[model samples]
Target chain A: MFSEWELKRYKRQMMLFGDDGQERLKKAHIFIAGAGGLGSPISIYLAVAGVGTITIVDMDVVDQTNLNRQILHFDRDVGKKKTASAEEKLQALNPDITVNAIDVKIDESNAVKLVGKADGIVDAMDNYPTRYLLNDVAIAKEIPLFHGGIRGFYGQATTIIPGITPCLKCIFPKAPPKEVFPVVGVTPGIIGTIQANEVIKYLTGCGELLTNRLFIWDGMQAHAEELCVERNPACEACRGITTKTPARTKK
Target chain B: MTVKIRFFARFRELLGTDIVTEVVPGTMFTSLITTTARKNPAGYAAIFDEKGAFHEFVILMKNGKRIELTDAAKTPVVDGDEIAVFPPVAGG
Candidate 1:
């Protein structure tokens, strides 16, 4: 079903997953929750990988401070909306895919509506309150939530399969105090790509997902390790939900 | 008895990780961490409040199993235990 240009554009990666996998990527809708450090790499990679629809939401304007890690924007975009900058860059990355960038602060009132029918939600936000909101939406929708967070040279990522694995609240019940957190560009660049990788694996039903484990990255030491994570029976966000669908079997 | 305490992310930076120290047979998890973290006042302050109780947001694990903050004060540490304490990194 691919056009001549489409096949050629995806030729290299298609060799790994074949046309069927490419079709899944072409049909998947991924909702990314930020346009800052993590969002920049996540959306860019997913767009180039040909995810069918990418809905990225961000409400901030591009400040000079964001250029270090928000790769979607440039010097000229300092005053521009992050959504506008992100949409332009993502569309430019893959003319074949659809990129819908919405400029709004994601709150309870509109979180579910914004994520409509998406296959997965990528947690790229900087704060826990919004991340918690996305976790709720993912649990309600019964979709996978790929979570990633970074600070300075340290990063953490985990894939949440709603009813099957630990929800965000189960893993980190209390939100850490928020501040203007220190960060370097490569931190999110690493964690975000892991998140994007998780989305790809989930959509294509290939390889092992990061589920039930927390992947911790220490760029300072160039060491990576995973700690087993379990769902809390008393998790406030997903306690009542049961898995309606079996976990995806690897192809 | 000797137990190894591992700190991650910010805690790792404030208090060095892979800390091996001897503890009494009945040392509680909270007291062990309070003693280890005290090596650095800032690190101690980061993990505990002025009242010397663990910060609610800090995560503790013993032998890879989560130990609830409320239980940490009563949870005893034994020999060869690998304890991990960390703050959830909250940035993009």
Candidate 2:
């Protein structure tokens, strides 16, 4: 059920994943949790890729200092709500897809409600408390959590399928002490793209997901590697969950 | 015996990676890292607390398996082992 314009808009990418795959993208809804550095690229890419609906939430106003890596905002957007700028840019990028940008801080009280019914949750957040909140919601909702983090020249990403892979709590167990972490735009650009790639693959049912492995990127060394990750049998957040059918296999 | 220690992210920045070092046969995981990380005071501080215990957030793995922070003190490193220590990169 694609319009003539929709078909033409998605022509090049459709070559890779025929009409059936295009339909999946057209029917999916992805929830991205930030509108800052990682969220900028993640939402833009997903929007253009024809994901039918994108729900991006952020509470901060764009500051002059954000222009370096938060590409969704511009000098003109300084002092504008990040959600407002994100919605405008994402909608402009793909008029065919729906973009719902919400202005609110994501906390345990609202995380689940905010994510309501989305096919997947993209962790574009900058801190661990909210990331852990999103992780709990992902486990509770039994959806996939596409996790990405960046600091300076280092970044890491992993795809967590609720019952099938190690949950975030299982992997880190403890949160790192908070600090004003240093970063460069390319760091989030790389990690965010990896996360967006994971989302596209998850939606369209192509390629092996980043399941059971942590992809670590060291931009300083121009190297990328993955370490095997396993589910902790005693993980407090997802311990009771059991693998039934792999999410990818469910596709 | 010989073992390879790989430090990642900030740890890697402070202490280089893929460090091949010699250790006594009975060396424990904690001591091996303590000795290697000692080469750089900042690196040691980043991974350990004032009391020299591993920071709770530091993840340690041997041959692709996770080693709990508490168990690292008693876990022995055998010949040809590959150890990885890193902090979760926390940013967007």
lDDT of each: 0.93, 0.95
Give the runs in model 1 whose Cα sits over 4 Å from its true position. Answer: A247-251
Model 2 DockQ reads 0.93
Q: Estimate, for each residue in A1-251, the C-alpha lDDT of model 1 and write its tens digit.
A: 88999999999989988899999999889999999999999999999999999999999999999999889999999999999999999998899999999999999999999999998899999999999999999999888899999999999999999889999999999999989988889999999999999988888878889989999999999999999999899988988778867445422
Residue by residue across B40-72, what tens digits does model 2's lDDT show?
999999999999999999999999999999999
Cα distance off (Å), candidate 1, residue A227: 0.6
What does fnat come to for each candidate?
0.88, 0.93
Give the distance in Å from residue A141's predicted Cα in candidate 2 to where it truly belongs.
0.5
User: In candidate 2 chain B, what residue range of length 10 has the lowest lDDT sum?
Assistant: B83-92
On a 0 to 100 scale, what is the lDDT of residue A242 in model 2?
Answer: 81
